[model samples]
Target: MLRPYREVLARPGALAFSSAGVLARLPMSMVGIAIVLAVPEVYGSYGLAGQITAVYVIVHSIAAPLLAHLVDRHGQARVMMPALRVAGLGIVGIILAIATAAHPGWVFAGAVVAGASIGSVGALVRARWSYILRDPAAIHTAYSLESALDEFVFIVGPVVATVLATSVAPTAGLWLPAAAVLLGGWMLLSQRATEPPVVRREAGASGGSSLRSGGMVVLTLVFAAVGSIFGATDVSTVAFADELGSKKAAGTVLAVFALGSMLSGLGYGLRHWQSPLWRRFAIGVVALACGVSLFFVVSSLPVLAAVMFVTGFTIAPTIVNGNGLVTSFVRPDQLTTGLAWVGTALGVGVSIGSAAAGAAVDQQGAHGGFLVVAASAAVAVVATFVALPTLRAGHAPAGRGAGPADYATVVPNSDPSA
Candidate 1:
């Protein structure tokens, strides 16, 4: 399990950028919880805090793909440095507003600005991997490791943010993430050697838009559904814990969820697959649906945690492979944007899921929200089947790039000694 990752990191400059990227992304998980804690503590209104966080998420989701498109056209360094700097300034302004008890409207606007300034750091990091490896066999390992790192980030980020806000200082959580955005982003931007080549748009090219590509819309919708499962499960888990008079159990149970995904991601990356991309995605969704459906039957916290652990087994493979599928269909010039769109779709889904889960938990109890997760996975499965023909058609006329049709076709050249 460790050997493959060690070999992948042995590539020139891989460790430096991957480490820096992880640092930059740690803030991605921190900011939400930090905002939920800080805004209410300072402003005395959870409503206002909720609104600020929602605006931040929506604006960031809308902005990420556009930022990635710019990163695609220009170089990563040129785009990332300015973007991270602006984001850092925005976060600082928000912190200052909180410290001084500025008007809620000013704070809200600052949050929007900060979110709009955030580049697609995770997608860009994955793009760097795609750029460096350039082989299907190698890229699979890279994506899996990246997904595992994501689990690790979410695991540590909330704990760090909460501890700093509660035990250290109310403003400490926000401050550290702001610093991370600046320092880590700057370090990542300094790595020029491994950056993806900027492919300028051809003069007469008609089809560069990833959104318009064949099956991409469906794929995006599937990713959105996947995101909803996460959102609904999170809120529902919190509600479950609250009902049990142990609100803090929310974090521990969620850690179980992350642990399940992290373990499975490591295992998934260590093997080579023989199925076609679409077929594997189909299998993944089915597995996800079956696993999440068990949530509807579990009644106790221990049972729920066990179900969550099982449910998590499907997430990493589904997401990692979905990303790989994007490489198969998108134009080389639009790879980063295409990948960013997946993140955007997930954001939108999470918002919808969170809202729906909140309403369900309020009206029907925590168990009600479990239905949403199962439904989401089922919906993704249906979308996969319905989109089969379009996906089989593969890349549109304009954006066809270099990806094998089947995973089995990827000749394994993973020399652990490399």
Candidate 2:
């Protein structure tokens, strides 16, 4: 298991950029929860806090692809550095507004700024991996490592944010993410050697978006459904714990869920399978759907936690393959934009799923929320099968045309022709 990770990280500049990326992307998991924790103390309204957080999420989802496009047009450092500064300022503005007890409008404005500018460091990091690594197996391993890192971030970020907010100060929750983004962003942007080269468009050629590709469209929609499962499960788990008189254990249960994904992702990356990417993705989706269906039958907190841990296994492999599919469907020139779309889809789906599950829980309890989770998984399964032909076509002849041999061969570092 560790051997594959070692092989990938041994690449020049890989460890530095990937480590920096983990730091920078920490804010992705932290910001929403931080806002939720910080806002209510000053404003005395959970409703207001949720609304502000929603603004941040929605704006970030809309802005990530645009920023990625700019990165493709210019370069990572040139675009992301300014964006990081703006995001930092936005966080500062929010903290100040909260401290001063300023009007709600200022808080909303700050969220908009922060969201629009935070960008997608994860997408940027993965783009770098795609640029530097030539072996398909190495690329697969690298993506898996990143996926595990993401789960690790989600596991640790919230606990730290929560502790700081409750024990230290309400505004303190926001400070960590702000500092993290700045420090991490600086570390990543300074590593010029690993940055993907900008591929300029040809004379008179159209500036086509990644979404125009059928495979990309299918992926975005399917990932949206996957995100919905995540959102619904989170809300329902909290509600379920509350129902069982063990509300404090909710965090533990959720952490177990993340742990399952982290472990599976690490293991999944170790393989050099001969299976087609589309087939693997389809199987992963179906497994996730089956895992989610078990939630409806869970009756106790202990059982629910166990179920969540088992279900978590399906999350990372599905996501890893979904991202891998982007490399297959999208041109190398538009790779970052295509990857950002997956993140955007997940963000949008999370928002929608959480809202829908919240409503369901209100009407019928945790079981109702689980119903939503099941429904979302079912949708993902349907979408995957329905678009099987497109996925199969897109994944056939990109870089992995020769199956396991592609994993053995290493192409040169120069960019492939657009």
Candidate 3:
């Protein structure tokens, strides 16, 4: 299991980029909660904090693909470095506004600005791996590692943010993430050795709308539904802990969730499999729905934590396969943008889910949010099958139906010229 990852990281520049990527991506997990926690301290309302966080995510969903497109047309360091700086400044502005007791409106505006500028570093990290690792199996392991890193970041980020906010100051939460982004962004950009070369879109290679190509539209919708599970679960967990008179337990519970995901992701990468990508994706979706349903009945904290750990088992596999599907559907030059669309869809879903689940929590308590989780998973399951005809066309050439030796050369509809 570790052999593949070991070999891949042994490649020159891989460790540097991977380490930097982990640091940069850590902010993704921190910022939402940091804002949610910090804003309430100033405004005295979780409602305002939630709205600000929603604006941040919604704007990010809209802007990430555009920034990623620029990265594809230009270069990762060129585009991403400036984006990181702008994002840092926006966070600083928000901190300053909150310190000065500026209106919530200013905070919302700052969030939007930050959201627009914080590029999808996770997607770019995967794109870099796609460029550097040509072997299909190696790519699989690399993606799994990346997914595990995501789980790790989520585990670390919330705990760190919560600690800083509770033990230090509310401002510390946002300030620390800003500093993290700057440091990580600089480190990532400085390691120019592993960056993917810019692939300019040729004349007539505008390739129409990417959303129309190879069922990307359907896949993105699936991602949106899946993302809802994440958003609902996070908020519900915190609410659950609060109800139990142990608010800090929320972080530990959530960490269990991430632990399950991270371990499963690592286990998933340890071997290659012959199962069809879509089939595995379908199973993962079903498992997630069933797993999350367990939360609906749990009344005790121990039971909830255990259920959450088990429930997290399917997330990474689902995400890994979903990303694989994206790679098969777009041109190499469009990879970053294509991944960004999936991330955007997820972000949009997170905003929607968090808002809806928060309302549900207010009305019916934490467990009520489980309804949203199960429902969203069901929606994703439905979308997967509904999009099957289109996906079958797109996945056939490189997926289960293809010869093993063909895996390296198979492009599906990914190459516009082909």
Candidate 4:
């Protein structure tokens, strides 16, 4: 089952890059939470505290593609080194500011610096693999494995962050991701001897500018829908736990929910599809939608766990397919930037969804939040269904539609002649 990953990691620099990904992400998840815990010590209002946390994610999401473009244009090591130190310094500044109760503005500013400096390591790491794994099958396998590893990061990063916040100072754990980015970037640079050289693939290609490609537009829509649902579902699940009068159940429910996703992602990595890309993707959509719908009906924690477990089955493969489409639809050189665009889209969507879910929980209740989740899934289903014909053809119709163009024209690799 693990042979494909084992085979891929055996290649020069692959393992090193993977380790860098872990190091970079370890602190990434906790960055927002750290802001939440620390800002409150400075300011009592939760809203102000939440804003400080939100700024980091919002800024990071907006800045990721720009940073990725820098790396795409320059070398990854060159772009990442300075950014890493900035992030580390930002972490220390935040710790000092909050410890001294100097100013809330300083805390917010430090968070932004940390965020902006953290460049999208996931995107950077994936781009590295894209340059190395040229074959379609190998690329798919690499992406699936990388995503599974990412899930592990999300799972572990949060738990560790929570523990650190509880046991150590919240600011202390902040150093991990910041330092990891630098450490990992340096480790990755050492592998430059075996690395794929940088390219200007757009310098003389014959395709029109990538801005109007159909695949990219579809990807944005798909991710927006999926990510929003996740954000809403997470907050809603906690709300439901509260509704049941078991506040502690929130953590238990979430763990099961994540466990479901982790196991399903594992299955997705190991299983080979016998169908076409669009067909598999469509099936994944159905599974995802069904899972979303189930949340509203299941009230008991155990049943919710069962529902969540079932719901988990489709997420990893759907995302894997969505990412796999990137290579097929865009030029080879644009892969990292393309995926960065998609990941950023999902991040934005999740932010919106989580916000909406939080509001729904506060106003309408868990049922209402769950309903919003179902509705979001329905939107994604409709969006993907409408795009299926064009998707199945493996390319857009006569003229490029929105998806391809959306990703293609963006920074990092955008050019008219390409």
Alpha carbon lDDT of each predicted model:
0.81, 0.88, 0.81, 0.72
Deviating ranges (above 4 Å) for candidate 3: 204-206, 396-418
Question: For model 4, how does the per-residue alpha-carbon lDDT over 278-332 read when each residue is reduced to its tens digit?
Answer: 6777788878998889899886878887788778767777887777766566664
Q: Which candidate has the top score in TM-score?
A: 2
RMSD of each: 5.6, 3.9, 4.4, 4.9
Model 4 score (lDDT): 0.72
lDDT tens digits by residue: candidate 1, 126-211: 88888788557678888888988888898899989999999877767888889999999999988888777666444455554788
Greater lDDT among 1 and 4 belongs to 1
| Sequence-dependent TM-score of model 2 | 0.94
Model 3 lDDT tens row, 227-265: 887888877888888998998788898899889999988
Candidate 2, which segments miss by more than 4 Å at Cα?
204-207, 397-418
| CA shift of 40, model 2, Å | 1.7
**Number of clashing residue pairs, candidate 4:** 13
Clashing pairs in 1: none
TM-score, candidate 1, is: 0.93
Q: What TM-score would each prediction reach against the true structure?
A: 0.93, 0.94, 0.92, 0.88
**Clash numbers, per candidate:** 0, 0, 0, 13
The prediction achieving the highest lDDT against the true structure is 2
